[model samples]
Target: MKFIIVTGVSRGLGLGLTKALLSSGYKVAGCSRSRSDALNELEMSNDNFKWFPCEVGDATQTQTFVSDACQWAQAPLWGLINNAGIAKEGVLATFPNVDSDELLQINLNGALYMAREALRMMLRQNSGGRIINISSIIGSRGYTGLAAYSASKAGLDGLSRALARENGRRGITVNSVAPGYLDTEMSSTLSDSKRAQIINRTPLGRLGTVDDVAPAIEFLLSDGAAFITGQTLTIDGGITN
Candidate 1:
């Protein structure tokens, strides 16, 4: 059986990715800041699902989380989804230092820690694996109020490109998926006017959903995507185009 790890499995896109992986017949070991009732329910119902509590920004905690997951699976891990992330929005000029640091810690460093640890395990197994970082369209495009969040995501894209080149010879593929505005709690804070503006700009006439994003990640983990690496797959309804 294939094994994969997904961070931030308690809600939103992370939860959707976990469900997709489980449904696709892969055993998933997931983590979040806390175990939510929804995650607990999933764990209880799905024999192939396991959940752990972790603060991905903490290097020690991230290392331990992946170590424990690798041990629990007792098999070669096939893929990793660096899906755990947080966003802080503010104008660039006044974006608080504290929020900037925290955003980088969780959004950028968290994915780095997980991917680094997972890569170690994948290398030892001698069968290269997939690493898909969940990024954002804001990383590539400019948005006035999300300077810190955008920087963190752009960093993820750079990480993916560099890692893919470093590990390509070993069959380990590293890539990123950058989604546009999504209808999740993450975007719920936006004003109705802002949301309407985004929808009007999007050719699809709507924001993305977890379902719209999860399949791209799942595909990256599939054999068909073996030839694809070091790329950022944008799911923004052609907004970037």
Candidate 2:
């Protein structure tokens, strides 16, 4: 079985993607800073699913997680999904320096660290693999009170692009999926009026869902997407349009 590693697997898109990948017959090694009941349930129900505890922003922890996950899988490292992130809402000037640092470490530096570890394994195996960073539309479109979050995501895309160039020759493709305003925990803080405004502006008339974005990740990992690299796929409800 092809083994893929996913980060931030406790909830939201990370959890959803883990389920989808397992159902599709991929062995997944997932990690989060904290365990969720959902993670426990998935492990109990699916032999293909296993969860680990990890804080992606910590370089030492990240290194250990990937190494341990791969050892446990005992399968070819096929892909990696850098879905671990944290978002803090605040105006740039007022946002605590500590909070901004944490956001960047987790959202951008963490992905880079995860990709580095995954690429090392993939390159050693000499099998081309996929690295998909979970970015946000705010990276490109921008939003109020999320300047740090936006900067982190924008940096993620830049990481994807540069890594794609660096590794394309090895058949390893790097890309990012930037989902629009989604009905997920991350976007739960939107006020009622703000939520309504988003829905009205979206061409599809609603927020994006985890399911809506999961398949795009799956496709990117498939043979069908072998030629695709360094691209940012926007899976919004045409809101970006």
Clashes of each: 0, 0
Best by TM-score: 2
Tell me, by lDDT, which candidate is best.
2
Q: Per-residue alpha-carbon lDDT of model 1 for 37-133, expressed as tens digits?
A: 9998999999899998899999999989999998888889899999898987789788899999998999999999998999999888889899999
RMSD after CA superposition, every candidate: 0.8, 0.6
- Which ten residues in a row are the worst by lDDT in model 1? 86-95
Cα shift from native, residue 113, model 1 (Å): 1.0
TM-score of each: 0.98, 0.99
Q: For residues 1-241, could you state the per-residue lDDT of candidate 2 as single tens digits?
A: 8999999999999999999999999999999999888999999999888898889999999899999999999988999999999989988888899999999999999999999999999999998999999998999989889999999999999999999999999999999999999898988989999999999999999999999999999999999999999999999899889
Q: Model 1, which residues run further than 4 Å from truth?
A: none
